[model samples]
Target: MTMQLLLTLLLAVARVKASTLLASHYSGQLYTLSLSSTNQLSISGSISSGNRMPAWLDLDSASRTLYIPDEVQWGQPLLKSFTVGTDGAVVPKEQIQTSGGDLHSTLYGGPNGKGYIALAQYDASAISTYPLPLTGAGQPLQKLTFTMPQPGPVPSRQNKPHPHSVFTDPSGQNLLSADLGADLIRVFRVGTNGTLAECSPAKSGAGDGPRHGAFWTRGNSTLLFTVNELSNSITAWSVLYQPGGCISLLKRQTTSTFPPGKSAPPGSKAAEVRVKDNFVYATNRFDRSFGAQEDSIATFSIHAASGNVTFVETTSAHSFFPRTFSINAAGTLVAIGGQTSANVAIVERNVTTGRLGRLLASLKVGNPGAANQEDGLSAVVWNE
Candidate 1:
């Protein structure tokens, strides 16, 4: 073979080897999947978590550590840590009991400049923080509970404060928790001693149910875009850095997660929200009845000056009830996991246009379950 052809073949092989994905399931399993350069997807390995439900995963690439939150409804859930091998498999390191019903978490710098995990416990109506480098099961460093006088507009879904997700701001000085039950985004200041002090919270529209959010920074302005699960919409907020380490959010606009002239169907809810280079992507679940047997991933463009968001289009998620989806580090591919369908899908993404092109590959890893039962896939993350 000519030298040019040999170099091309080597590059192709590298592309295939780089496209590994780590997927978590509600069935107590973590899977290592691979996507070929030609878009073929295959399961390479898996390990039983032995936990009730490992719902969310936060990866620390610098340390090659994976933090998984076990979401349990009744008993105390566990926060497990593992060392990810170079081959994409994981080895369990430690497990610590956390507050119940931990749905989502994020790793961020603590007050003392150490790594910390902020956990959002949905059922416990609390936010807990744990020190990094887990050694074994131990007490949380801090746990803050929330309460309200009465439920929001949707009493059934907003009976108490349910913190769905926890994330850090662009400066990493403040931590924000999206409380779905109370329709509020709670803010906390990271102190020098690794403690969190409560700051003023940002209130969303009644019944908006802010679940997950992403931050966008341009020049000196920072904007927050959140997917509201109850209202099936997205809200953009102008972030204001306060005098100290605290921050505030000024609501800008709210738009439907669906495309123009469209609305969510009955029992449909928005799931995940991710902000890429110049676009925002969110998942809508239970809306597959409109067209295909699959859910939809909605894309929106961010206005350069005002940081406003406008809906772009919607694409098939290639799975049913897509609860979570992750974009590759290159932003060239997306892996979506369906909760009820028990399927994982890979789709090509146009980084320039910020539009998902087509379904590349999909695989069924487990059996389907009911909508309410968390029996299938829960989350997907690129191993890179």
Candidate 2:
């Protein structure tokens, strides 16, 4: 069994089937990057405080660890941690806070079996739970804190409790949030120690500011899409998985990450809404980039008996403002990111006919405030 131990176990299964797509460019700080197959690419940045802003990132592949939600300045507002070493990269380590402040990180699946790192705390409309720490580094365990519900906008838009995005509900036991100034779509109950109770009120979309969302779990009738940046549109809903399940609003289209006549700004938004396998990607943050965040990945395609979303391909034309994207694991590759496209737009996923080719790499992340102010990029995937 020794030919150099079979070529180091065949290059460790060819770098785990050759996967490593990473992106996170959240503005002032947090701009990480990667892409592999021995292309061996690397880019990193870090800086914290000021606004702890590391925006969002999640990757828990059974504790390989990499979860972030830091937006802390004078303390209290973090859930940061990283450690994917062994050449798979990613290293930072610990940060943990979350008495609830500028939070917004995602990935939950731990009623106790392990894998929890959710947080969408707009100063406490709340949704924080940190348990992705299996003695890999420790220091996280803030556990329960769910309170969010003040929706029903209009008083100049309900003023506050804007818990942006924190989804999950395919009978994962519910925990869907998307409250841009509380326009609505909140439903929690996945407790065991990592808590969050409230329930119901899962529908609202007119000026539909409902931040990010996605879930089409192959269908049996479990669709759910939400990305209403103040009403640009993309609603969908229809999740009724009982245990106390029930979620309506089955349709709401109207998309435009900017490219059809264009025109968006004045508070600028529609940040993200990814869903892989059946295909679904969104991110429309024009906020003034000449009629669209310079065209940043709107591509859609899903109707497996009504999950609605048809518009296959637009990729911000050539890129610049995605702030997030993910869909790999042989589904090919789609890793994008945003905030002026700090860079990482791989595309290239023809896997048969899911369509999307060329531009196989756009890696250029390095300016999280010039070295690593935690670097601002918001989520990119493929660590699994």
Candidate 3:
């Protein structure tokens, strides 16, 4: 064989191996997908979740446990846990009934040095905490409810307090909830024995409707960046870690998620926000103006000192209504789940320039549906 041909064969043999990805669908299924080094995608396995709308998933790598929240709007929702086997099989472990509309959850360490699951119930206007290693249908250790004194600027969406997401801060001492209906980022202190105490909330712009957030730390500074669904904007806040396991978010900058001089379409809404290295990425849904086929993912460059972000560019998601997406551990590929398109797209990413490249692969997993109807894909997560 020729020398060049021999080198090519060797490179192919040494290429990155395929990885596993877990995706949640509104059709009550958890799918295990195989992602090849060449960026191809295929469903390897799937299991029924036994719930109507398992809309969000949180995987605890340390325990090989996956937490799924049933985003049911009508009756009481359920929080289910499963053991993820080595072969990608998910075995149900426990299921607990919770207040309706359990949309998001996260695992965090409590003051007792044990782990706890913090859940956000949007329709219920409540937050709940449960101890880790769920065994049975146990009750929550603490449940907190919120009431909005007045309607927000956007009365339609902010008529009540809706906590969209609950996440642990960088300090690992506090929990923050993005209250979309109240225009506040509610702070909570994790106390001994996995209890939660309410703290002063940080205010956002009127009608911002903060849905989800990601944190970035530089030296001693930590910044919280939230994707506002109502305003179609991104806001950066300086996270101040205070004594007694609490925090204060001071607003730093607010910028449109769309490109400069461009705004979101009438029905468009910002979905997800994520940070990798020095770059931040946010998604916009129902905006076909950017792409003929689907919505767009907005990229921004983060200023090291101020934590302010500058708009980088927008890239087509290659699928309609990109509700959720996950970046691999290598940060080289993005797996996007289109909520209304019922498809998953793998796109190349540039770690150095913070720019998204061409679409490598796309797979149709199920049937499509209307926006926010809970009839398609809900979450996509890498298994690394």
Candidate 4:
């Protein structure tokens, strides 16, 4: 290893204590993130990948490995894993070749936090489940792919396998894949040893273009809320939990994201949707247009029982493209990430009523776009 690389590792370990970071790849490398003692200071760290691109990073607690959706021309995009040393150097662990084309995003965990990775080939639509190992290095998973129901009413776009994001159900009995191209959410059932059992499909209503989704809170709830990139809105759905190993949608309704104006373009979808406490936050991106640089964070109060969301307030933070933001372990501060600015904004939130405040300390991103909108901020990972 080069001396420069070794020095980079030592600096990272000093900046963060008691918390690890989520590394995002963009502008050609992955960025490390962390918060201050008060969860205010947002820090960025990076490790170079000669020609490999790091995308859609996931922290696998069971394996203590950071998984990156890496693209290398030699073969296919891999679910590459790494071990973070005590001094913060990320040592490569495993590079599992995905059978179902390029691995998109590490699917959100099920009710039990059982990890699964979702693979989506643009021309095809499906989800694959990788059993999260119980301990030690994460076990290599055999791709258990679930092709979506093609003959549904909206078969034109829905005909192909276009899985975007995957997550397990609150009961851990089901897995769901949000199909952006198809505008439908696919569901599945899981076994103890990480086997998937098929079941019913819970629709996300018409043309919502579901992107990344999450529940109102952890454990126990029929409320499933998802971020719809096309519709430029977030929606709530009441799940009719059934006894026959199936879940039916009870209701699907939308919430406002932007003020009445030109709708979001086709490609730049809603980035990351997260639910902390009773508040659900969505970050809508302009990717290219970069028009409304004023209003960013869309805050909504979540109703867990009815699966409904009411507008709390839209943050006027001047972030270019806020993609992903995470509340601190104390839920006091939220670290906001911009896909275009390549910088993170540290914002404070009132956990009681879902109000937000800007923080004092901010970490300017490294390797910033010495150029333009083609690059900006990546994802944000917080340390407790």
Worst 10 residues of 3 by lDDT: 6-15
Q: What is the C-alpha lDDT of each candidate?
A: 0.86, 0.61, 0.86, 0.60
For candidate 4, the lDDT comes to: 0.60
Which pairs of residues clash in candidate 1, taking residues 3 or more apart in a chain or in different chains? none
**Per-residue lDDT tens digits of candidate 3, residues 46-160?**
8988677998989876677899988887666778898886556788888788765788998877653348888899978899888877755758888899997889899989999
Clashes of each: 0, 27, 0, 7
lDDT of 2 by residue, 318-362 (tens): 445565677766566667664464666666665445666666567
Tens digit of per-residue lDDT, candidate 4, span 324-343:
77776656567776665566
Give the TM-scores of the predictions, in the order they appear: 0.94, 0.31, 0.93, 0.76
Native-referenced Cα lDDT, model 1: 0.86
Per-residue C-alpha lDDT of model 1 across residues 1-384, encoded as one tens digit per residue: 987677556545556654778888888888888787777788999998757899897887777888899888767667888889766889998887765688998877754344788889998899988878765566788899999999999999999999999998888888899999999999999876557899999999999999999998889989999899999999999999889779999999999988777768888899999998889999999898436567898999998887888889888988888999998877777889898898998887776788898777999876676885778888888887
lDDT of 3 at 18: 79
For model 4, which pairs clash? Answer: 110-168, 124-161, 125-161, 125-162, 340-376, 342-376, 342-377
Candidate 2's TM-score: 0.31
- Give the winner by TM-score: 3 or 4: 3
